[model samples]
Target chain A: MQFTSERRLDGAVREREFALGEIPGILWTPGSVSAPAPLILLGPPPLGLRKTYPRLVARARHSAAAGFATATIELPGRGDRPRWPAAEQALAELRRAMEAGEPVSDEIVDALILPLVDRAVPEWQAALDALLSLREIGGPVGYSGGVISIGTRLAVVEPRISAAVLFAGSFVPRAMFQEARQVTIPLHVLLQWDDEGNDRQAALDLFDAFGSKEKTLHANMGGHTGVPQFAGDAAAQFFTRHLK
Target chain B: MQFTSERRLDGAVREREFALGEIPGILWTPGSVSAPAPLILLGPPPLGLRKTYPRLVARARHSAAAGFATATIELPGRGDRPRWPAAEQALAELRRAMEAGEPVSDEIVDALILPLVDRAVPEWQAALDALLSLREIGGPVGYSGGVISIGTRLAVVEPRISAAVLFAGSFVPRAMFQEARQVTIPLHVLLQWDDEGNDRQAALDLFDAFGSKEKTLHANMGGHTGVPQFAGDAAAQFFTRHLK
Candidate 1:
């Protein structure tokens, strides 16, 4: 990991931009810690880091208030990173289905999400490796945010993430159901009950398929992006329960 | 309302046993309070108060520690309260169906839950009237516990109950679905996801049916009585968020 830039978010939080190979990421740490703070990986919605920065920074600042470090890296084809034609083609197909008001087929979901999961999980793991190596960031790690397929794959494969808070999103590949059954870490899943474009039953089924012995599904009354503030507090409490 | 007994649970809480006519109930209040404390009515199952005292007292004490006065009343056919023959016959039918390993029909459910809700809702309202009249108790009221059908009815009818934490249980009458739609208070619902002998789909449907603009369903991986301590803590947090 090479530090590219740095700035203080506030007196309590410091933000550092870094580059790990070709992946660009940001890390936030508490200004001072008596010991190495617990780390939370703030997974974004494949929306690119610049667009997702405000929400990520809010979560990072909140975690810093409780003495934790948080980090996020750009997905393979997201943000300023290079994009591939196949990924672009899948996105076009997904848009066409939505424009025609047709149900998003399993094939389309798999085509769009499977490759993203395949490419993104490795980058996340690489970022995790570098984040943990930093002197200020070490302890039980947590992953919070979505494209939940990537979170599911990470929970199944990443030994360092002791807990996760997954936002239930649409376009989950059916094959990810099999991967979900391998996830054993404690999980806190947030579902927007009335998200217009999301598949509610599919989200519920994925929650049901999780292999974790301790999993919680918090379904709230809202459209997508309408998650309430209290819900965020509950998710933070979940992280505190497992990571601390 | 007549106080039958009064005592201190600890340095922080005071416990008082009371009678509203023939109905028996207990109230817990913070040991020291400047303003009138907020109230939470801790609803228990139809198991009778003697059987459910320990759990009720624990919740009461916990609420009191948060500077909230808490209370619970025995249902008509429960605790030391007089038992009706109709209620007795309903319980007999319910056990017989369960012993035969037959699915609990809606008829059986209505027979069991409807009468309790009918008898219980008014009593809870009356208790609210008396509890709120007390000098030590005031502010926003919350109801936390089950027979979920009772909670549903109370939430719809008792407007002073500005918030509630409803424990999802089996044997809900179909009629409550309509009443659930009328409940507009902020709600925090807890469901034991793998609860033995409980219908998970029905629970999910009830959660979906609730009309509250701010409602949450927290489904945990556990049996009926296996609600973890963290779940309890979350419910408390919910009450604190609204009640305070």
Candidate 2:
């Protein structure tokens, strides 16, 4: 079940069409495949990055060159599709979670928040499950990880997520982080000194609560978008070390 | 009349009280004051730094110590008793200006947006007018200026504003740098590398449109809040050089 890079009509850069159950995806591999090489299932930001930015393409290329199978799959309701009404749905779910005093686990949070991702969670899950199923068809899948920005980080803390490299992403309240502490995984945070939209310090404060030795921090040189190169490199290295 | 350090309050800083003209503000003079020092009114951000953040208070204090009569005036819809729906009003005005296809002047923009600055502009203007009306007021009331942040910058481009210092603010498209170029007054922009909510590069790109000699750019090390200290010092210097 080897994947090859080719242009797909879906407008994905170097896409390989595949299906997880009935959910279809384009497996976009960046470079040459080799043994013990990691596979990066990139979860895009809330407004999917594939159509809006070219940096994702650059990241996939770089990661593939580093002996990784990078797939930049399309999330539902993004890219020439009718956009999901995320703001209203997210606010409603946030209110519900707050009222219920429910511990916001990855699954619970995703179930409650997928509609807000601007691409439904079930679709994302289907794509993810499809990517995971590739492990059984092929050989051992060494790594499973993602990089999220701004609002996109909300979906990356899932139990299935092996490791994450977050960039100026928002964090749940202190209570939510505290409740989900047991499910902690290795996380690397790249924070900017003066980022206002996302409080870099607040995110750091939340990361500190993880209390896991696996966490690492890299302060970026510029604001939000400046870290694409840094994130791509760090993510590849992290995948190599942990996933391999 | 020389003014001395009076008092500092520590708590959730009151934006409405300041707006209602309840905060005690001082008039400073180099010698026995004869005329009002040309006023440079600054409109604080919608989210008051002093109220919510300690770092902002320290920065404000530093600016006050630097010889300017500094006040953090509240924007509308943000302080305790808001006079206007801040963001909504601002956005509506912006849309109107854009649709009209006319360049926004400082007065025109201010007239449309001042309700959004809450009572900050009027309070400062009242104080300045009173001080200038004094018989003993010695100095020539030759200039009026301001520093605008976020939405308030739209007000600074008024023809009457002899000088201005803008930080992490955006322009109203066509109005962009037209005010800066047309106004004979000097303008200094203290921009953050990565402003949280605003488009940093887009704002910076407007600088090129300004008449080169009339404008100066200070790319300092901070996010939005991080700018107050660095920007305050630079602004104080800018005011001294131009406003005085």
Candidate 3:
């Protein structure tokens, strides 16, 4: 891993950009954390890191102010990362279905999401290895919202991620539900009640599938991108309760 | 309002039992608030005050610690109040249906909840008038859990009640769903996902019917009596946000 750029965000947070092989990622840490701070891995949004920077930096600053280090990696098919023909075809199919006002089929969902999950989970684990090897970042780590399926898969396969805060999005493949039932770590799942592109029942069903003894579903009144500020604050509180 | 008895609870909360005409009620206030404390009217559980005292007082103590006065009144045909034959019959019918593994009919649900909502809303308003008249208790007020139908009606009719934390119980009358759409106050609704007697879909539907633009549904894994401790704390946090 090699850091290509570094900058101080205000005086409270330090931001650094890095590359793990070909995968680009960013790390944020408190400028003044005394002891080793507990680490939280931010899940990259499907829109890519550059476009999602403002929101991600806001989250990073919030977590930094709370005495935690946060990081995120570009998904394999997002941003400047290389995208394969299969992934591009899946996206085109999804757009065509939406343009024709048709339901997104399970095959399209699997093709689009499953491969990303299959690739991203290992890359996240690798990033964890590199981030934790740093002198200041410490475990027990947590994963926060990106793709719901990726979060579910990480919660199931990744042993180091002790807790997660997931945003429920539509088009999750059926196979993810089976993986969801195996997730035992504490979870805080946020759902937008009126998200136009999302199925509310499907989100609730996925929440019910989690085998965690301490899972909470917080559904707020909004469409996608309309999540209330207080909801975000509550998610931070959940991470503080578990990771701290 | 006539004070029936007064006691100091642990030197931090002062508890007073009162009678408004024939209806029995209780009031709790923080011992050290300099200005008038904002009030929260605790909704009386279906199982009368005497039986629910332990839980009610726990909530009272919690709100008191947060610098709020909390109060509750006995429901009509419940607790020390007299029960009419119709109400008694409704209870009997509900129990028989449950024991026989049959669905409780809409008629039974209306008979059981509608009368309570009708009699209780006025009594709660009267209680609010009396409680707020006290020098120690002030508004804006929030109504918290008991029978959800009653909370819905109160949210619709009672102007003083600014926000509510409603427990999404089973058997909410269909009429209340209509009233729920009229409720404009912010709501924080709690649903026990696996409650044996509660209909999860019905709860979800009622949550859907609520017209409040600022509503939240916090669903936790549990049966009727298995609501996790953190869920209760979160409800209190909701009240604090709106009331303060």
Measured by lDDT, the strongest candidate is 3
Chain A TM-score values for every predicted structure, listed in order: 0.98, 0.66, 0.98
The Cα error of candidate 2 at residue A165, in Å, is 1.4
Instruction: Give the TM-score (vs. native) of candidate 1.
Output: 0.98
Better of 1 and 2 by lDDT: 1
Clashes of 2: 10
Task: Identify the candidate with maximal DockQ.
Answer: 1
Tell me what fraction of the real C-alpha contacts between chains A and B each candidate also makes.
1.00, 0.00, 0.97
- Candidates' TM-scores? 0.98, 0.38, 0.99
What DockQ, on C-alphas, does every prediction get? 0.94, 0.01, 0.93
Best-fitting candidate, scored by TM-score: 3
lDDT of 2 by residue, B89-131 (tens): 6557756766787555555455544444444555545544555
lDDT by residue (A1-244, candidate 2, tens digit) is 3344356323433456554443334565533343433456655654564453466556666665666665545455545445456544654675676578764444444543434443444465555556666542222232222323212333234445566565545434434455335535565555654444355545555555554445554443345555534335545666665555
Global Cα lDDT for candidate 1: 0.89
Question: 2 or 3, which is superior by TM-score?
Answer: 3
Which ranges in model 2 have alpha carbons more than 4 Å from their true place?
A1-5, A8-14, A17-24, A34-37, A86-122, A135-160, A171-176, A228-231, B1-244
Task: Count clashes in each candidate, considering only residues at least 3 apart in sequence or on different chains.
Answer: 1, 10, 0
In the range A119-179, model 3's lDDT, one tens digit per residue, is 9999999999999999999888999999999999999999999999999965799999999
Least accurate stretch of 10 residues (summed lDDT) in model 3 chain B?
B222-231
* Candidates ranked by lDDT: 3, 1, 2
Model 3: colliding residue pairs: none
Task: Tell me which residue pairs clash in candidate 2.
Answer: A194-B223, A197-B196, B34-B136, B34-B137, B34-B138, B35-B137, B35-B138, B35-B139, B106-B157, B106-B158
